[model samples]
Target: MAENIREHLRRLLSVPPGKGKPVFLFWLYFFLVITSYYLIKPVRDGLFLEHLGSGMLPWFYLLNTGLGLLVVCLYNQVRRRIRAVPFIQTIGCALILVFFGFRFLFGTFPALAASLFHSWASVYNLVVVLMFWSFADDFFSLDEGKRFFGFIGTGGVLGGVVGGWLAGLLAEILGSANLLIVSSGVLFLGLVVVQILGMAVPSRRGKGLADDQEGEQLGSGFGFASLYRSPYLRLIAVVVTLTMLCTTLLNLQFNRGVELAGFNGDELTSFFGSFYAWMNASALGLQVLVVGPVNRRFGPLPGLAVLPLICFGVFADGLFAASFSVLVLGYGAALSVLYSLNQSSRELLFIPLGIEEKYRAKAFIDVVFFRLGDSLAALAQLLLVSTALFGAAVLQVLGILVSLGWLITLRVLQRQTS
Candidate 1:
């Protein structure tokens, strides 16, 4: 009966029959961790934009990148010292403690508290999600990742939907400060889910990469220097950086729209939550219906090109008229498609590499380089919004140019792989 059920799900979700149990567990784990993050995400965004003020966003992104560097360094050190499961559990617990502290501080000095929480949340999102996917890369072969990552990602998107909805519903009742307390609980639940996955799934080292089976840990490699040495890695870096840059651009626009829309406090929280809920729902649908088939049928190059093509249209439209509704739809669609297909295709690029390259190089690329793009985009956004440097019209032009570059780079990346 279990085998029969697995076969049915294989047809439905496109997971291989042999991969059914572990993939399902991985999906559940992603759901828990993402739900935990999304629960606090609205609170973080509202507090940051409202209390810290939008003008300070560049500084926050810079701080996030700096902290990302530290986090990755410490993460590498910790991974060396402990097993993956225990390391993850310890980090999750520490993050919960930090959230508890944020809960207390937010009540006392909201502005300062929001700044701190915003920075922490920025780093937390990248670190936790990257770590999860790093483990995921270990679990699946290159072919398996192409086949099943979309289905696994669907779980995270659905979790985002639920978390966003719950946060919106509860924001007024519990208040933003107390939302931190709830997030702490949700994070703890994520750790418990990790424990469940650990018991059910075999260690990647035991069944994963051939090099990894020799039991050599990460950190022996040159890390960021490795990216410098390889043209292929350089292009991958550009693709990731550009993708994140566009995301940063959209985020600033979306937040500005929300602020202009005149929502504040719990209303702001609820609004942002609803916006995320809608975005994630779109993403979930795309991941379920389009991502896997697109990857398999059209290949990763087309998957890579999809966002730039969409953005070209969105931002080109932005050159003439800009409004709250336009920002909502345009930015949300860009985010949905990027996170759905583009993101899965991006990770697929790493699957063909060695474990060290897969993990260490990945940590740097995913965390540091990605955040570096974020920081630069934030700085650009700051200059535009604050100085009115050439105004929003010029920013839209810049986005169009960037999208073209993104398209060109996709071709370069495809050639390198070919």
Candidate 2:
């Protein structure tokens, strides 16, 4: 078994590097975006809490979040020829949302105008990230991914660590809105970097278009029908999606748990900074050590599905008996490791999927299904927090059900594999 695993690792890593031109460009532009958006990420969370205050009923925030996510999703689906079209679209939409909301609310609560502005700005940056990674996945071949994968992820990890630390330090001085402006400016720089890289070295990876193997051809709005046709890809998507949803539930609960434990403001922001940095850093570490090896140790499908199945019961505990310490120490650390491991391996396996599935279907899962999961979890929490129909105990029960669904999804995957 050990010998076989080593051989598998060799095959995965043996792929030749990208014509460093495109990969180089990707590295340069990708991390810059990290530095840019991360500049605001830590500070923004605190501000979001401040604005929402105790009044942030789950539905109220969830409703706006869902609504905003919908608009962002639509905008994301809209593609244009100008390569930079999406970047501009994201930033422009954020600007419009901020300006409109601020103008309407500034008179009544002038202080919060910038807060609202920064809040939406964070959304815009997230859209950029979701799209950028999808674009990278679409543009790079599996072989190319093997070579550049670690290096590319390394940039984001470093940027996040630095950005998180900066926010922790700058909370009172630069203020959250200023951090947002900085993040926005960094994003603008990212847009510029992508364009420069696009022109300097055009992407030479295979087009996302497909042959009859996938139900439809690519470049046709991600060939949605053909995308799901691959039972393999479909199962991957389901597992990948459920994992993402679990991540959201863990993250939201973790933060709320922190505050419930009586930490706030700069201290809270610092804690977040530490948490996010560790998560990203840990993912990078696993890519080097565990991910590829584990996938080879277990088949791709089983490797992909196993983590969440095992973790579901462990994580389900957070919904009920969770506290700030327990949340951070147990759920936060455990889930972060789980997420990082799952994401790294999932990326490895995704290389085998059809190109359309790689780009389009992956995009839908990353943004829509992923957010759909988050919104649903939020709704669940909303009901629990608000009415009498449910509670944290119910959330634990639901998580158990999702876990069972996870196990069944694995059976479906194994059947497809046969």
Could you say which candidate leads in lDDT?
1
lDDT of 1 by residue, 1-418 (tens): 9878878888887765457778887788788778878888999998887886666777777788788788766765556445667777888888888888888898888888888888788778877886788678766787887777767877888889988888898899999778778877877877887787678775564444554434344443555767878788889988888888877876776676687788878998888788889889998888878887988997788888988887777777777777668778888888888878888788789878887687678766876667777887888887765677567677678788888998999898888898
Q: How do the residues 55-120 of candidate 2 rate in per-residue lDDT, one tens digit apiece?
A: 253454466466567666465455332344345546545654554454456446744753554446
Each candidate's TM vs. the true structure?
A: 0.85, 0.74
Native-vs-model 2 lDDT?
Answer: 0.60
How far out, in Å, is residue 327 in model 2? 0.7
In angstroms, give how far residue 39 of model 2 lies from its true place. Answer: 2.4
Residue 387 in model 2: lDDT: 70
**What is the Å distance of residue 243 in model 1 from its true position?**
1.8
**Off by more than 4 A, model 1:** 1-7, 10-23, 130-150, 197-226, 348-363, 383-385, 414-418
